[model samples]
Target chain A: MRSEEYLQKYHGVTKFLRILAQISFWLVVVLGAASLALGVATLFMSSDSFTFNFLDNIRLSMDGVLQFDLSLANITATTKKEIITTILFALSSFAIIYGLIISQLTSFLKTVENGMPFASANVKRLNMIGILFIVGSFIINTVYGLVANKIIHALGISTLSVNLQSDANMLFMGIIIIILAGIFRYGSYLQDEYDATI
Target chain B: MAIILRLDRMLADRKMQQNDLAEKVGISVVNLSNIKTGKVKAIRFSTLDAICRELKCQPGDILEYQAE
Candidate 1:
């Protein structure tokens, strides 16, 4: 059948989900950049010199060499912990909000797959919600950075050495976030194409 | 939510069997039954056009709006 033959309205929820998905995509972009910058900066020094930069600065207490004779192994252990924590923080926040949006989107998509036409406004609303999430993530990152700096000064670690181990981990996470965001955005585009074909 | 499909009405007025209508429209008997019973969540334009053309009726004739 010709695509133009279908004249039903777009579902409200489906549109909202698309927009939300796109917004998260952008959030990943901004967060990725900030994470990379901070991570790279920290790699130049030890936790003592790193000072508080965010909630992560609290981890400075873990500084100091391990008993392991292999220097590489010791450093690897510490770095692994920091990387895991950073990724967990990012993934958890996104998961919570995205989960809600995804549920709604899935419901809407099912209806659409059945050949129902939804209202145009509903699609626009979904788009707006996604954008809001993207903006919210950026704001959160900024707040985290500000708080981290204040805490570092309060702890008198401002003049200390940079935490090379933690910084390396952060840098890796930043790169990952950016890449994930791109992949997600691409997914959305594919969804649109799929819908159109249908 | 209270909109009623007048498919049965059309079928009766045209004195056509459900099976014959389904075959003529190139749709399955199950789907035709769903439409007749208002169990369908949606109707594609192509499907609507096919039914209308076959039955010699308009969409308005088969769709009725009723307040909930």
Candidate 2:
């Protein structure tokens, strides 16, 4: 395709995707907020009838007794409640971080749609996203894994095994994005110089 | 801006208006004005060649270097 054709096609796609990303970001925010509020409410409820458990990777259910799928056997009621609370907070934090990534993506796409792919703002946004992904994965995924493993070991639950592996792919992807951001900064410089030239 | 464009002095010496020089050089008056005012960071060799041909001078005559 011709350069103009490619640019036109890219712009059309960027505009459409930006709108989609905006909608998706808002949806994630609303869902994350509602889930967090519900979880917190159940955790704080003083009634004996309200029982909750975080089972598996995604252990949220709207059941009456809030019982988790994980048959956390040979643990006291207090310990079980504590574990549930930890999962609740961790998952909520994870959701918010995930939503943040999406929000950043929406903003990035908006800039692309504005026909300024080599803008300095894009470089900063990509750098921020790279940090968020790497740091968020470390804090929410790897850190949580370590804490969960310790809790499991201390509790002596051999049957239960939380995912102890960190996402190496995500870490590598973050590094790649950071590298891309640097390259983008160079591209922005060239673009500015080109525009300034007569 | 160590290399200064002496286009104004050249025009004055020739007793020619900027518009006449711009017309002879096949360039806009605004572009010639930019070159005159040192607003442009750099000038194209082709533009400088055209200006020199029209003004009957060498490149050195239109450009001068002064230490900062």
DockQ values, each candidate: 0.05, 0.31
How well does model 2 score by local distance difference test? Answer: 0.74
Best by DockQ, which number?
2
Best by TM-score: 2
Query: Which candidate number would show the highest lDDT if scored against the true structure?
Result: 2
Across residues B7-66, which tens digit of lDDT does each residue of candidate 1 receive?
Answer: 999999999999999999988898898889887777778888899999999999998999
When candidate 1 is compared with the true two-chain complex, its DockQ is 0.05
lDDT of 1 at A197: 26
Question: Distance (Å) between predicted and true CA of A182, model 2?
Answer: 1.2
Q: In model 2, which regions exceed 4 Å deviation?
A: A1-5, A47-87, A143-157, B6-39, B44-63
What are the per-model C-alpha RMSD values against the true structure? Answer: 13.9, 6.1
The residue-by-residue lDDT of candidate 1 on A65-177, one tens digit each, is 32212112223334533543454454445454445555445544554545543434334434544543554455445434443343343444546433322233334444554
DockQ of 2: 0.31
Give the per-residue lDDT of model 2 (tens digit) for B1-68: 68898999999998999999999888788878988988777777888899889889999999999989
How high is the CA lDDT of each candidate model? 0.56, 0.74
